[model samples]
Each structure stands twice: as structure tokens, then as C-alpha cells.
Target: MDDLNAIATLLTKPEPPAEAVTRSRGRLQDRMRGRARRRIGWLLPALTLATAAAAAVAMLVTGVITPAGAPASGREVLLMAAVSAERTPQGSGTYWYVTREMRDMDIPRQESWTTRDGRRWSKGEPGDPPGVVVPDPDPLMLKGAEVSIEDLEKLPADPEALKARLAGLQGRDSAMTASEQRGDPLFSLITLISELPTPPEVRSAAFRALATMPGVESTGAVEGGHELRFPYPDTTWEVKLVVDPETARVTRTNSLSGNDGSVLLSAGFIRVTTGWTDQPPR
Candidate 1:
């Protein structure tokens, strides 16, 4: 279909090569789309052609091949990210500033600044327009209630406690439809960690909470990120996120595929920049 949504510019990955590819190459492409995985190092020039051909034939005959060792699943990847996030130094300043854009939408990018204590918030317009200080409508959803930045600091660091606290937020989320209320609470956690400046330990707890969620699964890998799919109430389409495990940042909301082909859908704001800033919104 020629619909814009069918080819939305979400996640902003490099375009695939236009030329036709062979089946062996197609196999590799399929793996990139979520399947068996194997990390092959550089092929030595001295290796015999027969040996290479034999390996190719084996992969062809037996679907995808993985050498010895446990393949990394989505949960394992998230757990690894949790550890990475745990060790990262936390940032501190007067305000937590954020720049975000909805890639698939035509609206202008938005910027925001919130006092560390969450007492005040401001919305910045595109270009040089001055930021308008707004009311404290920026409470984070947790345990079916609104939570301020001060409360965020006091959240439990334990994965299980954090999970219970953030998961139920989705039920009370006004943005979610009645049907969406039945969706996974991981959605709430992911949204918070992706854009909000939660404490490093709290972010780690959220990652750990997601790791233990029942249906979180590795869909595949993306350049500079790992893609994981989560359960949503809607069955018509799938929800996947491209996450940078090193920084524990969710880079993109989703990259979905269908019978026709893959459709890149970006439903949420792409966090362009977020961290503590001493300077006021410029």
C-alpha cells in the first residue's frame, strides 16, 4: 500500500539496498527481522571454499544455525541493560530538560523543562520561541496514581516492588482505551524509562521488572540497538521497541511488519535529548 503510515519514517534506520538479494542473504535478512541468531566474526581469507559452502548448506537445510551457548532472549537482553543502567552515574541539576518528536506525525518537535522537584514545568516551542511555563501536569503514572519527581526518588529499588508499582499505572492511564487497560504494564515502565528522568536505580528496577514480565520477547536486533516485542491488548498489530542496552534508553517505540511488508509505526515521542540542565529552556 502507498499509505504514509505503511512507510513512516520511525526509528530512522538506514534504508535497505535496492538491488535484489540471494536466498542466503535473504536468510540473514529474515534473522534481522526476528529469528534464530548467530554472531559470525570475520571469515578468514585462508578458509577453504568447501568449508564455507558446507556451512551455508547446513544453515539452509536446518533453518538458522547457532553454535554452542545459550542464545540471548529479550528478557536476557533487558537484564543486561538493567545492569548497565545500574552502574551509570546519575545526573543532577535544577531541571530535567527533554527534547522529543513524534517521527510519524507532522507536528513540530516539542521541548520541555521540569524542576527537579516537579513543582514547575515549561513547554518549549519549535525554533526560538520562548518556553511557556505550564502547570504541574507532568506527574508520572505509578500504581494507578500520579507520582511527582520527589516521589520518583523514593520509589522502591527492588525489581518486584517497582514492577507492582508501575504496572498498574496503565489501568488508570486516560490515554489508553478501555480495551488497552488489559494491556501489559511493561508499557508503563518502558514509557517512563524512555522519556522521564527517573533515578538510575529506578530505571534499572524498571528494566528488571520488564525482564520478568511473561511475554517480553526478543524480536530481533537493530543497528545500535536491540528490538524487543511486548504484549498489547490490540491483536491487529505488534508493538516492538528498539532499545540501547548500553544506556538503557528506549530509542524507538516500534517497527512492525505484516503480510505485505514491514511498517514502521512510531506511536510515542522519540526522546531526542533528556538529562539535567542548569540553563533555562532556550
Candidate 2:
């Protein structure tokens, strides 16, 4: 079995030593940070591939699984996120507004805002204009022909049925190769659910749906909050969702490259403030 599968199998067995968990988490975090600092472009591909292989071996030796059948750790986390999302007050407004700060390895700090009605505004740097609406299609990209806020609201809350519908939609994308289409269904579903301006129930259902996917793993608690990770499509990097257990809402989503332990991308709304104001963000 691979590292992930080994961890899953071990999770079904007995708990590893607390020391082992610490070691595993430390190794993963350290490796990610080290990769982020390196700037050599050509060596990255080889380094990433080698890193993924080494990580699998490290997982096996570290024995990172919790007690088997003791309730999946990831499922519990997701359930909590679902409940938190359900309780979160959806602001009353003609349009939904989200503001967030983004940081990457070499990129300067950027602040941005997005509206549910498909408008994007941003500030380039600290001294730049606070807000200027940019003509961009990214917000609309969140809603496809079949999957929209309206469509998501109609989706069944049942996990299995919801997963199946997401799978069916995968084939509708004519641009993807057959191999890509056959990749992880949960990835697409989660991406769509996370980005779209869906109802609270729909958002809740999405988390609940993810709880049912096999091989999902929980990293217990990290610096900001609890983390639940899912394997990505043909990549060593994992898709990580950081949830504030106290509030049960996802604070951030990260594409963590396993090879160099660097983050490929991170996205989330830092604050969502909505009201009946027709004026655009100033």
C-alpha cells in the first residue's frame, strides 16, 4: 500500500505513539517550508517527484494512523465544519461580498474583494487604491452551465447521491483529457462547493458529502486551526482545508505540494460582510 493507504490501514489498527504523530507532522511542515524558500526553477520538477516518494516512505515508517474504526478523524472534523456553516448567519444583501488577503512565495501582499453577483475589485499594494472594480470573469467561472447557486440548492443532501451527481458533471467538461476525467471526483466537487455562493444548507451538505470519501485524513490541529487533507489528482501535493473548530467554518484551503512542502495556492475569505447597500466597495 502507498503512504496514504498505509495510514488508512493503520488508522484501523492501533494508535501510534504520540511521538510518532509529532514527528510526522513536523517532517511534513518542515519540508513544505524548505521547498517554499528555494527559487531554482528547473530543479523543482525533479525535487517534487523525489519528495513525494520520500514522503510515502516516511509515512509508513512514522506510523501516523490513529485507532481503527474509532470514527474517522476527518469525518468528525467535516461534520463540525458542516454544523458551523449551518449556524453561520448569511448576511441579508442584494449581493454577497467577501474580502481577503493573499500571499505567495514571491508575490507581494494583495487584498481583494468579490461579490456574489460576479464583480471583482482589488487593491494592488498598501499604497494603491483601496478598491477598484476589475473586469474579470473569474467570479463567473465558479458557476458552470450545470452547477450554479440555483442548481446547488436543489442538490440532495445525501452524500452518495451528491457525489454521483458531481461525477456525472465531470464528463461534461470536454476540455479535460480522459485521464483527468477519471481522477478524483471529490476534488472537483469540493472546489465547486467552496467557490460558489451557495446556500447554507448546500454548503453544509458539501462538507457532509466529503466526510464519506475514502482515504481522507486529519492532521489533528495545526497552527491556525484543524486540518483535513485529501489527495490531489496525480499530484503529491494534498488539498488541505483548515477549519476553525470553534466556529466550524473553513478559514482557508491550501494546495500543499508534497515534494518541496511548498504551498501551490491558498484561497479563502478573511471576512464576509454583507448588507442592503447598492454601492460598490469603496
Candidate 3:
């Protein structure tokens, strides 16, 4: 159709012979061509404007805006497209959780628990007293049990040394025998070990720790800053960690990408602005 239009435009350029114009209904044909050109000229802008508007609407709805500089207060914000989950202060030192499930990934399942650090735990191990369950537990299950951040600190100060210990621990364990398996403490230990700023020798161990995590992938640095990317059932998300450079303690975080690659649902990013506070969410 475009080709035909182009040809018609070329043919009508000089309006044909004026003497040949009145011959054999040429005048009528010329009139039809003139009317067609006028109609096409009007339609083009309307279509272009409509296309631009649709693109703008899609961007707004997807939340794919360029993020601003990282926040200051050691507070963290995590977003999965328009849906997001945040850990904030409920009061001076206490924390709370707020999550918006825009994609319905079944993340806030009935089997959920809370950690002392204020993060929500879903799919815990058996008899484990309901903590976070590392979802993917193949090749590296049977580890001892979960432990706390403080407990991990009690272990070796060397990250490399600690990782070796973790590998050995996970190797001896077997699959859960019952619901009690859900409460295993290794998940907590894994979290602690992965988040800590360990020596280079232990960096591989941190990656290994993150690998055994049910839904977590890699925890490392990106663009010269620390980053953690985790996989939800339907989406994989990236987060930039905000840390106290001196303490190696993560102060806050920002979401990098939502739905980087997944089979289910819309695979795209949404943009949002957030602020973190020292206090916890209520």
C-alpha cells in the first residue's frame, strides 16, 4: 500500500496534461487524486502523534525512569517494576516492612516469617522456627543449620576461611525429613556470610553462599559499588547496596532492574523515587 501511494504521488506531481486532463474522464480522475492527497496529509500527523503518546504511556506505566544518586541514611529500597518491597523504620531504631506486589509473584505466601533484622522470610525450612528458606537447595544442600549474623561474626574473621567452613558444613547434610527441616538456620548464616565484607580469599565463598540461597543469585560489586541480584519466581531483580565504606555495613540499597529475565508476566522495569531513614518501619 505504501508503494502504491508513493507511485500515485509521483504520477500526480504535475497534475498530468491539462489538454489530456479533459480527455476520457481525466478531469474526474485528477479531482479524485487531489482529494486523496488532502486526506492523506491530515492522517499522517494524527497517526504519528498517536504513536508517540502510546510510547510515553507505556514508559510511565512500566516505571523505567533513570534513578537519582543513592540515598544517604543506610535505608534500602527494593523495587520489582511498579511493585516494590521496602524495609524501613517503624520508630527510632526499630524497623518495619512494606511491599507492593505489582506482578502477583506469590511472594507474600501464607508460609512467611520475620527475621530480627526486619526482612521478611518466605518458604522456611522444617522445624526451623520459620525463617527465610534458601529456595534452590540442590548441588549444595545438607549444610549444617542456619545461624545469625552475630553467630557468623563469632566464627573466623577471615572470609576465605569462613567460606571453606560453610562448604564443608553444607556437604554433610541431607534433605529435610519433615516440616522441621523448614527451620534450618543455615539460611540465616548464608545471608550473613554473603552480605559481610570479607577478604578477597572469601569472595568466592560469598558467591557460593549466594548460589545456595533458594532465590538469590550473585552478591558482589557493580559499577564500582556493591550489588545483589535475586530471583523471584517470575522475575529476577538487581539491587545496588549502599554501605558504610568504613564498617562494610550496608546502610541502604537501590533497585537496579526488575524482571531482567523471566518467563512469566511482563518482563520490564518500572521507575520510582524513594528515601530511606535511620529509623525502622512501623
Please report the candidate that would top lDDT against the real structure: 1
The CA-based lDDT of model 2 is what? 0.48
Model 2, 1-282: lDDT tens digits are 754333334434544466765665555545554543332222111124233323323333335333332322776666555555555554455444443334334434343445544465544433454344443333323112333345656866555566667666543344333423664456545544444455665666677677777778876544334557787656565677755543444555653111111123454312222223345655
Question: Model 3, residue 215: displacement in angstroms?
Answer: 19
Model 1: ten consecutive residues of lowest lDDT: 2-11
In terms of lDDT, the poorest run of 10 residues in model 2 is 255-264
Q: How good is model 1 by TM-score?
A: 0.61
Ranking by lDDT: 1, 2, 3
Candidate that beats the other on TM-score, 2 or 3, i.e. the better one:
2
Q: Please, what are the lDDT tens digits per residue for candidate 1 over residues 1-282?
A: 321112122112342233322444444444434533343222112212232233233223222333323234676567656655765777778878766556566766666677765654545543334545455454444434455787777777777777666545434444544433654455567655665677888887788777777777875445335667776555555566766665667766643221121122455524355778798755
Candidate 3 residue-wise lDDT, 1-282, digit = tens:
442223223322443344432341333333323432112111111112222222222222223221232111111111110111011111222211222222223333223223345353333223323434532221111233443324443554232455456444432224322211333333323233223212322332233233343444223222212234343322244332322121222333332211111012223211112222334322
Per-model C-alpha lDDT, please? 0.54, 0.48, 0.28
Q: Please list the Cα RMSD from the true structure of every candidate, rounded to 1 decimal place.
A: 14.5, 11.8, 22.9
User: How does each model score on TM-score?
Assistant: 0.61, 0.56, 0.25
Q: What local lDDT score does residue 220 receive in model 3, on the 0 to 100 scale?
A: 25
